[model samples]
Target: MLDIFLMGLLMAQYTYTGYDASAHVAEETKNASTAAPKGIVMSVVISIIGGWILLYSITAAIQDGSEAGLTTLNATATGLPPAQVFLDALNNPTMAKFLLFIVCGAQFFCGMASVTANSRMSYAFSRDDAIPGSKHWKKVNPRTGTPTNSIWLCIVLSSILTVPALFNETAYLAVTSVAVIGLYIAYVAPVLLRRLKGDKFKPGPWHLGRWSAVIGWIAVVWVIFICILFVLPPTLPITISTFNYSPIAVLAVLVLSIVLWYARGKKHFMQHLDKEQLATDEKKLLDEIDD
Candidate 1:
């Protein structure tokens, strides 16, 4: 029962993965400090409400209650249980296909949004010279005012990463796990840092106030718990093919990040700008405005 609950929780976390898109695009947004946080909160709230309705409707649509029905849905021709449910519940293949098309369209837009967020983040990192080949990736297109180079880099890398799914079926699950775990860790790192800062941490334009510590700690714990769940084997008697590779992938990334940080980032990465640097930046902005 606990295992089932954990698996459901893991899937929920996966579904909730991309809510931080608001933060990624903050640089280009007006009144970003306030709007970005509101965007994040609203995105999660909307997802929860919409997801609950969708899940309830799908659950209600499942006509079969037996183990055989489960087997049928699992082995459906569409390879999607929801599509099978729609077909079975509606008794109309055309309607099911149309519904599936709508779902696919939504997913296409979701992928585009993910790419946009990733490119912006990559551009930001490159702008600080934190990534290799920063000079190229940091380039913004004059006409579009977008990071064209970083966008293509993200697209190419995403395509390359998906190639493994063609040969290895389990690769898709492992990749999704890596994405969820990687994203959540990135999301929580700053919260963890702020918690470490304790009373020294100043409140932002929007904050949790007195409930901040409690809510922040709960979030930290939940992220850690889900991250652990994502890396665990999904089935019994795990063999090479059945093994969860997410942990290995995540460890490799951590090792690579540590190596890179020590090699170059430690010296070059500025965690905070000094007063002189801030003044220079302010002056630069003022000069640009004047021009």
Candidate 2:
């Protein structure tokens, strides 16, 4: 029961993911310091309200309280529980298909936003020479001011990552767990750093003021808790087929990152840009804008 509760909590967190896209696009936003934080907050707030309503609607639509209804939902012809609920509730195949179509459209937009955020992140890292082949990835399209190379890199890498799911269903779960765990870790790192820094940590325009420490600690702790839960097997008496591989995936990434950092990145990667270089880049961007 506890494991089921934890899994539900983890799924809720996954639904709340991707709000950080606001922060990733800050460089292109107006009054970014204020706007970006507000965007992130509002996005989460809206998602929470909207997601709750959607869930409530779905639950209310479950017309059957009998074991037969459960069996039908579980063995849905479309292989989707939600679609079965819609079909059973409405008794209309066309309506269920329409609802599923709407869901697919929403998922497409969500994926697009993720891709955009990932590409921007890669571009920023490449600009700092933090990644291999930085020279190629850091290039921006002159006409669109977009990171075409980084965008393509993100697309290709994401496509390759999904290939494992084609062969094994368990691999799909592991991939999702790894992705969520990785995202939450990235989200909480700065908050944890800020808490550790205490008085030395500079507060940004969107800071929580007197409540910053409390909220930051809560965020960090929650992330750590979920990360642990994510690596645990979802089912008991787990066999090879049901094993959770998120820990293995995460460890492999950590090892690879450490090796790369020690071998090359530590020497070449600039953690912070020089003030003169920043100014030069700003001026160059202004010149390009003017032209």
Q: Give the Å error, residue 200, model 1.
A: 0.7
Off by over 4 Å in 2: 66-68, 271-291
Q: Give per-model CA RMSD.
A: 3.7, 4.1
Clashing residue pairs in candidate 1 (N, C-alpha, C atoms within 3 angstroms): none
Report the lDDT of model 1 for residue 110: 89
Scanning candidate 1 in windows of ten residues, the lowest lDDT window is 282-291
Q: Output the number of the lDDT-best candidate.
A: 2
lDDT of 2 by residue, 1-291 (tens): 577778888678889899999989999999777788899989999999999999899988898857897777888778789988888888988988999999999999999999999999999999999999999999999999999999999999999999999899899988889899999989998888878887875555665688878888899888999999999998979999999999999999999999999998998897567889889987775554444
Model 1 residue 238 distance off true place after TM-score fit, in angstroms: 1.1
